[model samples]
Target: MEQNRCEKSTLLLSVVIGVALHGSYSTLFNPLTGPWSIFPLISLVLAVYCLYQRYLNQPMTDGMPKLIFSFFLLGLFGYNAYLKTSNPEMGSNFFSSVCIVIIAYGFIVKLNSVNVYVNRKKTLRKHRKQSNINCYQLLVVNTARF
Candidate 1:
């Protein structure tokens, strides 16, 4: 559990750094037609892949909302990229900012759910242990009566 938390935190940190760079460069650099474009594009692809993988790995009922949100953000990314491609003069800062916000929200939601799941597991384990002890106690009492 500790390892899982650490890994998650690391992933979250990477996402934050990627978003910060993307947002900062969107206004100053042309994200569509220069060397700077590569990093943002790569990050976008990576984000999409991660979202899709999460969607697939989780149950439909559990992941549906997140999947929908991921698609929405993906749509926005495509639209923004299109705009940038069509008109190099138009700034993509707004789009990048939007992406950053969506990613942050998604990560927060994911983290919350993970915590909830972990708690549930712990509770279930405790309940099972208690029930087992109760069953053993009842068995002993019945044997004594017999």
Candidate 2:
């Protein structure tokens, strides 16, 4: 159960990071725009919630962050691909940005998974030790009765 919770939290972290980065890029690339500003604001709220959950050592509630971010990325990619097809000059930038985002996303997921897995293993070891201690106590009591 704890392991499951940890995995969920880790997944949330990955989503938050991904969204936040995208939001940052949107704001940087297009300043003073109302729609682009919304992404960063939403990202900020989610980031705060993520930090609070981390501080409390609790799992984040499963939410729509991943779905929204995925859709945003897909839209961006489709738009870029369309642009590249129409104007070959932008093909290199489109591919490079896509490659960078993919690599970063992979790294974040892998790092979070390792951290969560390690914590889960440590908790499992602690639980096993506790069970072993109880068993030993039971054996001692039975031997004493005999």
Candidate 3:
């Protein structure tokens, strides 16, 4: 259960970070106007929440947060890429963003795998200890019967 929570948190954090970066990039390069400008604010809020989660060492267990943010980032990236398709200069920026997101995602996956392996080792050690205790108790009970 803890592992599941950790995994969820890691995924959420990654997505939030990605969105924040993308938002900042958009704000700097494209500068959304009027009501649409609220996007950067929303991204700021998410970035703060991400920091708070990290500080508290607690992550949201629900999958909704990550899913929603992931979709938002995907849409934003797609729209931006589509808009810049005709511009040759923006191609490098788009490529770099894609590479960064991929690297971050890969890192998180590797971290989660390591976390799972460590948790499994701990569980196995606990089981071994319990088995030893049971064996010792049985030995003592048999000796007492004699």
Candidate 4:
């Protein structure tokens, strides 16, 4: 579980960094004439792969909402890719910023939600244990009184 979390966090960071850099330089560096267009292409392909995992593997998990986020980001990424290709001059930081922030915030929200769930389970277990002990004590006292 920890390993999966670390790997996911790393992947999200990489995508965010890539988006930010691509947005910043895609204009000045003129990515259209070069191979840099591959960034969005790769992103879209990975998004498809992610969708496959979301539905093809098995019943979805609690983390399935994160996949929704990836799908949303992937859709936007495709749009940005189209705009960049169609009208290179129209590209702006707005698209890249939104994508990067969505990924970043999604990663954070997923992690925090998992943590909260784990903590809640732990708390419930503790409460149950204490209640069990109290019940046992009450039984003992009633038996003594009888």
Tell me, by TM-score, which candidate is best. 4
Q: lDDT of candidate 3 vs native?
A: 0.63
In the order shown, the candidates' Cα RMSDs to the true structure are 8.2, 8.7, 7.0, 6.9
RMSD of 1: 8.2
Clashing pairs in 4: none
Q: Which lDDT tens digits does candidate 1 get at residues 1-146?
A: 66545444434434444453444356456554444435555666666576566546643445545545454555456445555656768765566567757776776888799899989999999999999999999999999998
Question: How well does candidate 4 match the true structure, expressed as C-alpha RMSD?
Answer: 6.9
Q: Pick the lDDT winner.
A: 3
Clashes of 3: 0
Order of the predicted models by lDDT, top scorer first: 3, 4, 2, 1
Q: Would you estimate the TM-scores of all the predictions?
A: 0.47, 0.37, 0.45, 0.52
For candidate 3, the 10 contiguous residues with the lowest summed lDDT are: 29-38
lDDT of 4: 0.61
Q: Write the per-residue lDDT of candidate 3 for residues 79-128, one digit (tens) a residue.
A: 45544564545554566469548755855886698789989999999999
TM-score of 4: 0.52
Per-residue lDDT tens digits for candidate 4, residues 20-59, read 4444355447646445555655654664565456456545
